[model samples]
Target: MNWRNFLAPYAQVVEELKVKLKGMRSQFEYESSHSPIEFVTARVKPVSSIKEKMKRKNIHMDNIEELQDIAGVRVVCQFVDDIYDIVDRLKSRNDFEVIEERDYINHKKESGYRSYHLIISYPVETIHGERKIIAEIQIRTLAMNFWATNEHSLNYKYEGRMPEKVRTRLKRAAEAAFKLDEEMAKVKDEIQEAQRIFKTNKESDD
Candidate 1:
């Protein structure tokens, strides 16, 4: 199948999901004074990158469906607990069907990566009618997002063959980031209350 034929639908999925998820965050901030999500980011993998990943993972060209992250959304939160809360809300939503979940927070990778991943199949309407595609949603705290973002950048620089020095530093950095999240969790209630007050005053000024 020509991947170009898939691009428009994939873009539709990314844009629609990004809006819907961000809207959920806005609603929660307004109604509960506590939003589990700090921010949302998304992407539809480039055709070239997808093809490269398929080759690297030993996935056949015909089995592109096996790669779940072609359409990806990432939800960043302030505290680790917030990650699961957002995931729970996602699971309860009807717009998409949750295919699987991976809790790397409780079970970190060998590289000390931590996040909660959800694989979902979402239906999108097109001229050809309805089509469903698997999308991956990765949820993590801001600290974890920071670490992952940097690691990804460095990995690309090394072409996946990271030097031992950088690898060791990344491991240390991951530990430090998680520690920061834990520390923030200890005072989350206080921080949230301050945030609500600031937002309320700012709105009043407006």
Candidate 2:
């Protein structure tokens, strides 16, 4: 297939998924005082990236279906509990079919990466017909996202082979990020109350 033909369905999946996932965040905010989702972002994998990943994974060039993350969505939340809440909500939804799940939160990767990942197949309407594409959804806390983003940047700079000292520091930073999430969970109510009071006082002043 031509590049445009190959990527068209995945592109549509990314756009629709972003809207659907953001709607989930808005729904939570409307239903409760504290919304779990902090923010959501998405992307369709570039052709260069897809080729690099296929080569890295030793997948045959023709095995495009083996590439699960052609479309990727990231949902960042404020609390650890919120991660699971968002996953539960995704599982309950019918718009997409959840095919697999990886709980990196409970079992962190050796590199200290942590997040809950879901592989979903979503059907989108096209001129020809409905097309189903595999997409990956990653959910993590804000602190986790911060640490992961920095680590990813550093990894890119190091070209996937960081020195031992830098690796050790990254591991420690990951632990600190998780610890911060733990502490935030303990005082979530107080934090919410403070936010409410701040909003109320600001409204009164206005």
**What's every prediction's RMSD, in angstroms?**
1.0, 1.5
Model 1, which residues run further than 4 Å from truth? Answer: none
Compose the digit string of candidate 2's lDDT tens values, residues 1-206. 59898888888999998998889788876676788888999998889889888888998968988999989999999899999998998999989999999999899998899999999999989999998889999999999999999998999899899999999999999999999999999999998888778767887999
Clashes (backbone N, CA, C under 3 Å), per candidate, total 0, 0
**Candidate number with greatest TM-score:** 1
Which pairs of residues have clashing backbones in candidate 2?
A: none
Candidate 2 lDDT at 98 equals 99
**lDDT tens digits, residue span 1-206, model 1:** 76778778888899999999999998997789888988999999988889889999999977878999999999999899889898889999999999899999999998879999999999999999999978999999989999999998998999999999999999999999999999999999999999999999999999
Q: Local error of candidate 1 at 146, Å?
A: 0.5
Least lDDT summed over 10 consecutive residues: which range in candidate 2? 28-37
Residue 206 in model 1: shift from native, Å? 1.4
Residue pairs in collision within model 1: none
